[model samples]
Target: MSTSDRTWDVIVIGAGGSQAQAMLAASARGGDVSRWLAVDRAWRPETKATTEALGMTTTALDVLTSPQELRELLGSGRLVANLAGPYYRTGTVVLDAAIETGTDYLDICDDADVILPMFERTEAAEKAEVRALIGMGSSPGTTNVLIRAAVDYLGSAEDVDISWTVDVNDMTDAAARHFWHCFNIVDPDGTIHPAPSWEQLERKTVTFPGTVGTQEVIRLAHPEPITAPRFLPVTRCSNFGAITPIESLVVAWSLAFSVDAQRPRPDLAEVTDHAIDVFRTYRETRPATPRIGSGMQIDIHTDGNGLRFSAGADTEMAEATGVPAAAGIVLLLDGQTPNAGVFSPETLVPADFFTALRKVSRGGGGLELHRLVNGEQTERIRIRDLLSQTAATPA
Candidate 1:
């Protein structure tokens, strides 16, 4: 598309944590001549001020009632980066707008209920020629891509298993609160759906990787469970929880239980105040330990031909979450994504995108892929072999 056709190189939909990271990364690339627009339910004066401080523009757009307005605002932007959430409640409308406008769409969604409907909309999106990528954030985003990368190394993957954990405290003030609210809404019944870690009917367990051993992790239903099975022929696909500690999980669980624990109601002022309090507490109690801030650990295991292939990474949560989505945007803008349909990160994003992402991840965080044969672990493996293995394996 010509520069005029792509009026805005990137149009970011929300002024939240992940959106900030995305805008920063895109701007840093510098040559693309990109402009960012931050839109939210209410005018976030603080976020508007922050974006202006960074030299960007901000707009106030209510996601619920502004489709034509959003379409008009999007104009000729080549892509839309959605950062709004409790996605199960508020994501599809934006996706619908993007599809109608024929603009490429991407979001950092991790909600299964939200995604299943989006996936079902793929044919409509394709018909409209709109490329929509879902779950482009950390866990559902890079974690999914990483697992696919590792499975490709094993020559043939018979089954695939994945795990990811984050210290919720590592997120920015707004992000932490957004996550808290989402957790509360999803798990309010005192039972986290799709348990954090489960095996059998996808049984759940908590185990630490490498030196830490495994700790008790609650099983929660995650989008990955739903998306992976539909796309990959693996017999079993599951996600496990590994939050900071039992204490942290307990606190989170408690908040999930309390009526208004993390809900973003009462008023914006109250939400903001509560978010600040949570941030301050995490800072005071956790401090800024080198490895603690916001780190993610992802492990993928596949068994085939009497061999096992696995890959895992321990890195800053922000970078892990931001980079993959940024990379996906790059691919989408460059006309690299093959289809104009709704798809999960792993299903649509190519393997090379991860390789390109690693090159740019130099100072932020590091990613490693591993291979294990007959119960032995090695630091590296071939990507082609891994994909070959998964492809060769029976569904």
Candidate 2:
């Protein structure tokens, strides 16, 4: 089938690496292997081979340089999910292009700065009947969904704390660039502020189920808190995150900041490479926390009561961000998420999202839901089970 006719189901722009590859895998695992299309600025031959082996099509086009080509590609009605990020910049390529073409859009945009601007385009999306789901990655994406779920379960949520710990060893080039941009947050008053991620003053320690065990997390400049209050009826929310192999975040941040403070301002790409090299070397010499890959946990409170939910696996940066992105797209394509215009993951019905999340994960994401008693986990159940219990209860 032709893309303009009945052929392609989804075309992923900026589809060259692990994040896009993971999305393709999950989408294929959920069916429709033959109708996928891929585009990348620096698409490798092996990546092309991988796409072909999966009964897919791929082409290389720099989204930044080739606007017309991207517009032509996305002008069709097929769903377009962009995995390429550092969304503060790439949002122009994916989000703006989709909206301009009046196309439905999905992206794993983790930058809070971009999300705030995306909100301003709500009128355009609604006018064009576009359903733009941004920040579908783990920390911002699934984290937002899980927060929504807990809020729904608890009846109301006020103080919500979401923390994530990802292994530094899994940092990719795009991820590194994103690491830099997340620190520079944009406020509603148009003031761009720097987040104090490396400072020890805000350290909060928490435990996870795996080798990720327990680690200290500081406030991460992420999209959750920025986007949550806009969509959710919550008074307070915060996103805390840290990269592991101990003190790696400090080293990485120092390197990047040192370079940024240089005269004439070096390009962020160079800064990313330098920081990544040093951080990786630091991680290599230090004890490699292999089994302790990454994890995210959420604490939701209503009045004086609280509940906690955590969904984590021994996954890399890409899989953690990509899998749920694919799950969210699947929900949109399956007509489960029918709302048009701009929306967050929480805007989705919690039951539908968790069910698809479990399916796309192929039954491996360790999700736990528990009641918090005196700031301690009291009883644990499958996070998905909360949906079932909610179903059985009469409204």
Clash count (model 2, backbone only): 1
lDDT of 1 by residue, 158-214 (tens): 455555456545545554544444442132123333212112222255344443345
- Please give the clash total of every predicted structure, in order: 32, 1
Candidate 1 stretches with Cα past 4 Å from truth are 1-6, 16-19, 41-55, 171-215, 259-315, 348-351, 358-364, 373-395
What TM-score would every model get versus the actual structure? 0.75, 0.90
TM-score of 1: 0.75
Query: Which candidate leads the pack in lDDT?
Result: 2
Off by over 4 Å in 2: 1-7, 185-190, 195-201, 260-273, 280-291, 389-395
Error of 2 at 222 (Å): 0.7
Question: For candidate 1, which ten residues in a row score worst on lDDT?
Answer: 194-203
Give the RMSD in angstroms, all C-alphas superposed, for model 1.
5.6
